[model samples]
Target: MPHSLPPAAPLRGRFDRFLILGAVCLAGFVLPLNFTGPPIATPAIAAELGGSPAALTWMTNAFMLAFGSCLMAAGALADGVGRKRVFGIGIAAFGVASSLLAFVPDLFWLNVLRVVQGVAAAAALSGGNAALAQEFHGAARLRAFSLLGTTFGIGLAFGPSLAGWLTQTHGWRSIFLSSVVVATAATVFGLPRMRESRDPAAAGIDVPGSLAFTAMLAAFTAGVLEAPARGWGHPLVLAALIGSGLLLALFVRIEQRSRRPMLDLALFRYPRFIGAQLLPIGTGFCYLVLIVLLPARLIGVEGYGALQAGLLMIALSLPMLVVPFVGAVASHRVPPGVLCSGGLLLAAAGLVWLGRADPGAGWIAPLLLIGIGAAVPWGLMDGLAISVVPKERAGMAAGIFGASRVSGEGVTIALASAALATFLGAGLQAALPGHAGRVAEIAQHLGIGDLAQARALLAPTLDPATLIGVYERAFGHLVDALAAATTVTAVLVLSLFGGASAHDIANTHEAPAARADGRPERVADCGAHG
Candidate 1:
């Protein structure tokens, strides 16, 4: 039988939850910094390399796809091999990859390095939560999760600023170098004190299941990301989608029967868990749409430099720093459903407001609302997700939640890119009405300097002001679409809260003794020998 050890004792004495928080927070800093840093230099990088417009996106998407697909395996590995060991390995890999990225000669090599970096990130992110869940349970667990959420918020909040400063002072290569330094520091600080948490007997890594799931994720993500460039009907795109579906079916079948599955499908039985998963997906879709588009719009359409755009974008992260503590305090007194639903609603409202922001509007006010709105949902979602799962399976739960958020963001970006392209093409046609035909003709000529010649042909008649207006309108339309999606998420979260409110209230009123031990003691059963 799986060991049924009591939940780990709440941190007592000098070494408490705070130490664990600091250690894990150090590991958390590298991810958002690496992920968002590249995008801040997209225009510069593209210009310098003479790369395709779409090439810039791969810097971020490559990482997201690899990170999302590998998280499940990372979680299971942590369970079998030990969280600290897995974390150290991941941190080391990330540091090496980051160092390599600093010296990459071209975009292709950079993408290759990014994929490696993503795998390393998966190991750290997946294991961090698992280790925390194992080390701290009950109220202490809640506090630990809140701190993790805050750390993430802080990273996102400051990452762009850091990237902007680095890119300005030392160029884009500096961003990768920064990652190397941070990852190296985390490895050094974390390795000595980090404890092992995997319960070996219950934590068998399902290699076949992991492989199938990875194929499914990779195929589906590739289809989604490439669909904008290659129409959805294209053969390769269609094959990827079909293959993903089939592989996913196979993964489910394998997991259902596996002696020890990588995913704990049983957790979905809880409404809270289901809501937590879906809400993040919805919120992620909105969040990525805004974060990706805002900087591009500022830099490309508004003619702001990379640093200016990045500073404006910092609004997205600021609230992330403050909101989680609010959520943490509320978590102690209020039901998570209320906090989550309210946060989603706030985010929806902010997106709608942002959708209507004038192109020339003063930046501070709009950005402040956007920052606060984003922070609240981000702050609450992860903690709420972890709260719904039992301690033994927290790693699996965290992996699934993180994966869902990333997948949603990836799909959203693909769809948004297609929409923007269609809109921009139409706008360009309007802006260059008289020269449109000539521009198209030149574009298709395939002669030397064809693109430059086409630009020359269209340049005289293309009204810059009108073109900017069109792009802004299209951006607004995209933001509106994001707002709609966020609103739908808000409604779903509210409905969940309504449905579960009574049960939570009942639990709240239970005597202290009954409620104090409401969570079951199942740590030993988690495949850990100890």
Candidate 2:
């Protein structure tokens, strides 16, 4: 049986709904801030609390991996329990975790706390969004979600600059402290106004499926992040890589057998669904990786101050604020396939252009171009995610889509970061022939935007200018590779999204649901409901 809402009369009014939207938006805003802030603060964090290259990477990866892996489970938990209850718990836990992060003394504890924060975030996001959905209908829901997206964009747009200012003025720890305040406000204001709701038909949480998927993601990410430090052939690295594959196979088997699988393996049969899933993964490499890596490059290799680097990053993120709305409007006239695939192709070009631009004054154009291109799919992916699935399975589609996007970002950043470290180390080895053994250590520092520490590891006779040049070259190569990858993804998405009209797909390949006349029931397009 489908879940049903309570009587509309007592649920909420216009003002109350707006209040709920505001509260949810507040909580939602912090999530992007958490993601974008750490990379900017990374240099300062390293300067104050030392960590290994992999450990430093974990500061960000731990949060993302935990959040992504737990999101589907968190959604199910929210639906199984009460949305308000889970939302409040998540917000309170997030505040507490963030408070602890502010006082953490070492990298290990900080990473652990970040994972806690991530799980809290997953709960908060899943519960908050679902609760908000219950509060509005039709056009109101569309507008509410749009505002939520804008809030997230604002967070992404300003998080780096805000974090930079805070890091420069107070300390890296202030970033966590600030997030705590946002979480607190969200909990205080949102909880009372929100009524409790749950899915009566929701099965218990899929523990086995969740565990297998989480373990697979963790194993794979560990292999990727550790590989450059520990050679690919190292026992642990090999074990993690092999174990990741085994876990993935096991996850599929588990899901197939489960009465209520977290993911519907049958959904993968749809080419359009696969294409929709690719949108985030494509942007993950072309845009999300750059969001983390660019600030480090500006601060470490190009010798920009944290504040300067953050300000420069605005060019890349600002388009997210407005271009998405434009793309959403443009979708009325143009097919989404063109908009999505074309946007990625444009971003790929921007990546190539960025690779060639001078580090200082020449960056804004390419960054803005990339931002504008990536924003299109960013805006439309939610609708596309649901449009490709059966109407009854919209929630499942959304949960899986969210997981894919977040998990893809975590995995992509690990791979990109490792590749960057390898390239930088190789460059440094060639630049300083006698210091090959220490290049990995130096590259690790440089990779996190700790140029000062990286310099200390080098010979006093070696010019700082040579190291900067080598870093620039390595980064350039990485950008070129990202562009190539994005181009290939764009082509694949184009092929996948083409060849069939939505009507044809719905008529021919609709789920087993049938009409009274023995005809297959047509699946409605997401836009029709919106």
Best by lDDT: 2
Report residue 19 deviation for candidate 2 (angstroms). 2.4
Model 1's C-alpha root-mean-square deviation from the true structure amounts to: 6.1
TM-score per candidate: 0.86, 0.91
lDDT of 1: 0.66
Residue 348, candidate 1: Cα error in Å is: 1.7
* Model 2 per-residue lDDT at 125: 80
lDDT of each: 0.66, 0.79
List, residue by residue over 103-169, the lDDT tens digit for candidate 2. 9988889999999999998888878877776776544555566567657666766788888888888
> Candidate 2: where is the Cα deviation over 4 Å?
1-11, 138-143, 387-395, 499-530
Taking every candidate in turn, the Cα RMSD to the unseen true structure, in Å, is 6.1, 3.8
Give one digit per residue, the lDDT tens place, for model 1 in 1-530. Answer: 33443455454434644555566777677786777667767766766665545456677788977887788888778766777788888888988999998888898898888999998999988888787777765666656776777776677567777877788789989898888887777766556666666654444567888789778877876676566446679999899999999998999899878756676665555455566776666656556566665666666556677787777777776777777787667655766666666776677777777767665456556667656666666766676666554555666666777777665666666667666655555555666667554533322211111223234455655445655565667666777777787778777766655434322422322111111222222211111011
Task: Say which candidate scores most in TM-score.
Answer: 2
Residue 506, candidate 1: how far off, in angstroms? Answer: 13
